[model samples]
Target: MFKTRIILTAVILLALVGVLLANMVQRMAHLHQSDAEYLRLFKEVVAITKQSYVEQVDDKKLMTGAINGMLAALDPHSSYMPATSYDEMKVHMAGAFGGLGIQLGTKDGNLMVEAPIEDTPAFRAGILAGDHIWSIDGKPTKGVPINDCVSRMRGTPGTSVTLGILREGSKEPLSFKLVRAIIKTKSVKAKLLEPGYAYLGISEFQERTGEDFERALKTLAADNGGPLKGLVLDLRYNPGGLLDQAIRVTNSFVGEGLNDGLIVSTKGRSAGSEREMTANIGDKQPHYPIVVLINGASASASEIVAGALQDHKRAVIMGTQSFGKGSVQSVITLRNGDGLKLTTARYYTPSGRSIQAKGITPDITVEFAKKPAQPEKKKMPEIREQDLDGHMQQVGAPKDAPAASEPSAAPMDPKEQELLGKDNQLARALDLLKGVNLLKAGLK
Candidate 1:
């Protein structure tokens, strides 16, 4: 009873002191004043925390935690990022990063895969973006904060880490032992798939993505050595990065592939002068046909290309609904080595489709899975003010309106619906390409 009373007294004293200190801080901020009492209270708390706490705590961590808490109250996307997190953010915005080559984020404070980079260990290990990381080496992660869990997940090269994952439709949590390797994210992949289709996989719209794609195309052209068949641009699971890179990709399809097409043009100041860049400068429009593959994971920059192609009648877009992220975020480094990613603009397609919440509807629609039903929630694109400078305004969709809030005519047609489903969409695209090819060969 005596001990309990003592503890209660201490708590009461602490609360009183905290209230007093808080009032002082507020008054000081308002009056632009300082006092010895404020300093004394702050120092006293620091000393008490260091000397009397039950467990050791980092001062820097405590300060940062306070900052993060303050920022989090403002919005979900706005928060304090430490130096390490800031660096990773830079790498991601730049469209590449070195690590295990997996994209990860927090869901309910537990680490989950956003997606694994193609051919990386996480991909090889079959770690999917939506898989929940339940534990690290059998250590329970429930209720664990994401940052601490990530630290345990990442380690030196050649080191093995065990992950306990819970995938959708799994009977029980599965365990996988994976070795961490140095991952330099490669944004573009190209290959010859069928006789008439050259397949390309693009992970994101990173800074170097366009250059990487051109090189991939060169290799494809050199290998074919004959008349071009059709080009398949696979932009599944691509969270957009750079705006210019997206434009460059669209330009590649418009001018030099196989037929004549329109190049995307922007009109805003600082968005700058319009130039018609071609595949070969004067090759007219591409002579061959094109098919674009997109999915719910495809976002921002990817949508720009897809929307532009569809608007210009340059390529038949295929796959599921894309991520509706039409907004652009420009990362500005702060004085503390952290980054501030702020929304910039809203982008529009040549036909003026707002890719915000309403992603670009493919000319053809195909679900990712063979038989997809409604209720499987796919990621919606993040459209910002940064995404809409050049593209045409929606038929009636407002240029400055928030995503999906603008008025629309009756929903788009059936042909567009087919162009946006998953597998069926790709097959229909092949049919379109073959027709283009036959026409080019005078075989139509």
Candidate 2:
């Protein structure tokens, strides 16, 4: 009886294995058939274009354009970079490039200026964020690829390029003739606001931004004569840079307790693209109040840092909503020194919030505006009883001794006043930090 039972079980197992093998073979055949059909279609189209196009097209150019079209169909951030463009990108990541110092993006098929790097030609030429690039050096840019636009704008140092811009409030397109220079960006700028308060502006993340951020923090402390009480991290107009640098910057303020020190995580179809980056155990800032200032131009790594800190309750986010750019692109260097930047994943904050099309909203919504002008001191009418005609006099009290004049406030520092006058968002962040510090000390 036992031998008969074993024989039945073996026969059942063999039948199950046969069914699985048959399904695998059928799926493989289907995939092969589909792939061949697509390849044939692509070849036919290429041949037709080469033979009957309006103009003679180079084989390399045709292939490059095809690759670009494929990537563009996927997303805006993904693109194929030829060897020259790839080399330029490497230089750009290293924090120096010869261009107009303006970051570009696309919106509804129109080329738009993302942000002008601080102190660059584009910035100095009054290029504002959200301005549409109508033409580049007399050539229409409506349908040009972003990489081609960038290449056209960049040239040897001291060269000039004219951009026709369409600003929101302007009736006609404005022209800006800017002389390009080698743009060497200083990523971090720090200054002490008061004895215990500091301001750190990260223009953009770069190769050494993390290390530079740490050094700036130390410098702030030294300038303040002790540990900082509060900080205003200004990330306005900061189009983001390297991913690892963003993580490193976040690690400076966050310690290893909340959410298991999870700063950010990425989710993708492939296992290799999915990842979680956590804060390492190291020297971190004390439990000081922080207010991170972001604007509509803050994107990518900027969103990453803001999201992480906001999730951990480590800082108060201020300013307008951030420029939502949560997708991660992995740049793969191809043979022949060309490259491909492909969108691999979408990153999430510690709280599992995705910042893709939706941006990081600030805890405090402060719009950008100039500091209001101080009202003129109106002269009093002097309409007291003493000044009234036929009014009763103070018989005993000696003519109500003129009210002692209040001491005038000490003059504000010229630089501080200038800064507050220009940046109302930063001014608001400073006020909030000050209020928080006062509350912590039980004085408010």
The candidate that achieves the highest lDDT relative to the unseen native structure: 2
Off by over 4 Å in 1: 1-80, 93-182, 255-286, 367-422, 439-444
Q: Give per-residue CA lDDT, model 1, range 336-404, as digits (tens).
A: 887666444455565555566667666666665556476667766644323533332332262311110
* Model 2: per-residue Cα lDDT over 296-320, one tens digit each: 8888899899888888888888888
Local distance difference test values of all predictions, in order: 0.66, 0.82
TM-score on alpha carbons, each prediction: 0.56, 0.70
C-alpha RMSD of candidate 1 = 17.1
> Deviation in angstroms for 146 in model 2?
13
Q: Would you give me the overall lDDT of model 1?
A: 0.66
